[model samples]
Target: MARTPVLAAGGIVLRREAPPRFAIVRLRKRNEWVLPKGKLDDGETPRDAAEREVLEETGHDVEVHEFLGTLVYDSGGRSKVVHYWRMDAGGKPVRALMSDIREVDWLPLDEALDRLSRGYERVFLENVGPIALQAAANAERERRTRLRVAAAERRRAQPAEQEPAAGAPVIAGARAADPAPVRPAVTPEYAAADAGEVAGREHVVEVTAPEAPPSSAREIAPIAAVVQPTPRKNLIERVRDWLRRAA
Candidate 1:
């Protein structure tokens, strides 16, 4: 079976002002703004390839946030599968100096769409834009959650710092103090009086036990006589009958 031609592609939404914008890299030779992408090397995963390609094609270091989708296209009579990803560039921009990449430039989405050479590249941009936005949102939410958790942890930690020193007595002269509050004791005479009052109340109870009737009176039928037999023969008898029949 022929192997699938897999390529890894990465695009950055380089933000300058509010509502951060995507940074499109322009090739030095062609001066065409396009997403940084490259074919996957042996043993390299799609994510690793995408990151490598983005770094190689663009001077800016990037961290991949999420996978965008796969793009299938025909190249030199072979089907090429390009894995797309949303990436965030770290710090300021740098120039891509690889042999294949002539130069790199960051462009706004509108400018990039106008300057990009291929129509398919526009489709890739469209697909990656929403995913990148969602990734940014998720990152913001995670940051907020972490901040809240850290604040809660700090609050929890503060109590321990403000707490009294360990082994310190809670009450001064506690051992010499008169005594803690005590409940009144119940005298035996009082308890007996209470019990006598309770005994005066009328009540009835019904109880039964499996005791045989008096022998002098009459005998009752055995419990076995009332029980009905199941359809199947007992295992012990069946085994014996089987053995006898076999013999």
Candidate 2:
């Protein structure tokens, strides 16, 4: 009869760096460097167990993501099964090392693989390391993209300044000059019409000689005598005058 496999869970915790690093722990009793993991507690789900175990072993808080893969191996006379999930650790450890862990070290994939005392773990990291790093890189890119979009939105939200009208004065150190007073322009025809209207309103005055002042004194001088008319000469005289002329 086949025996039931001993079930365990753990994390492949990654710390973000220039080239990312993976977490591995040294065992207290066996004195071997291995992936941080432990067997499941009674009634605990595999995912929760994976998070708890990683925290206890690595002494760093982690955010767990996708499931990596399973490792099936032999321990004593029983088959062992360990499930793993990809996780991200912060920059610094938040707690002390767990009693079962002598120390925890973060290393690059190749070095982490070589550092593991178990062959199965080395092979597992070899397969899953690229996947975890890629996921981290993709997430970082998405974060930067969101930040850029948010900045663009903030720029759009601000009010735009109104541009001054063309030909308007731009003063350097004082308020803009008040606009020049505008005069209504008139055509020559209108100016001529206005002049005619003013000329038409002029008045013409007629001055008669003033009446002679009343005579201050009564008239005293008599009128001069009129000359008498000449009398006609008698006919005889007229004849004698003619005879004389003849003689």
- Top TM-score model: 2
* Backbone steric clashes in candidate 2, count: 0
The positional error of residue 212 in candidate 2, measured at the CA in angstroms, is 81
All candidates: TM-score: 0.56, 0.67
Candidate 2, residue 114: the lDDT equals 86
Error of 2 at 73 (Å): 0.9
Q: What is the C-alpha lDDT of each candidate?
A: 0.64, 0.79
Residue 103 deviation, candidate 2, in Å?
Answer: 0.2
Per-residue accuracy of model 2 over 151-178 as CA lDDT, tens digit each: 9999999999998899975544333343
Residue 170, candidate 2: Cα error in Å is 2.9
Instruction: Note the residue pairs that clash in candidate 2.
Output: none
Find the candidate with the highest lDDT and give its number. Answer: 2
- Model 2 misses residue 83 by how many Å? 1.2
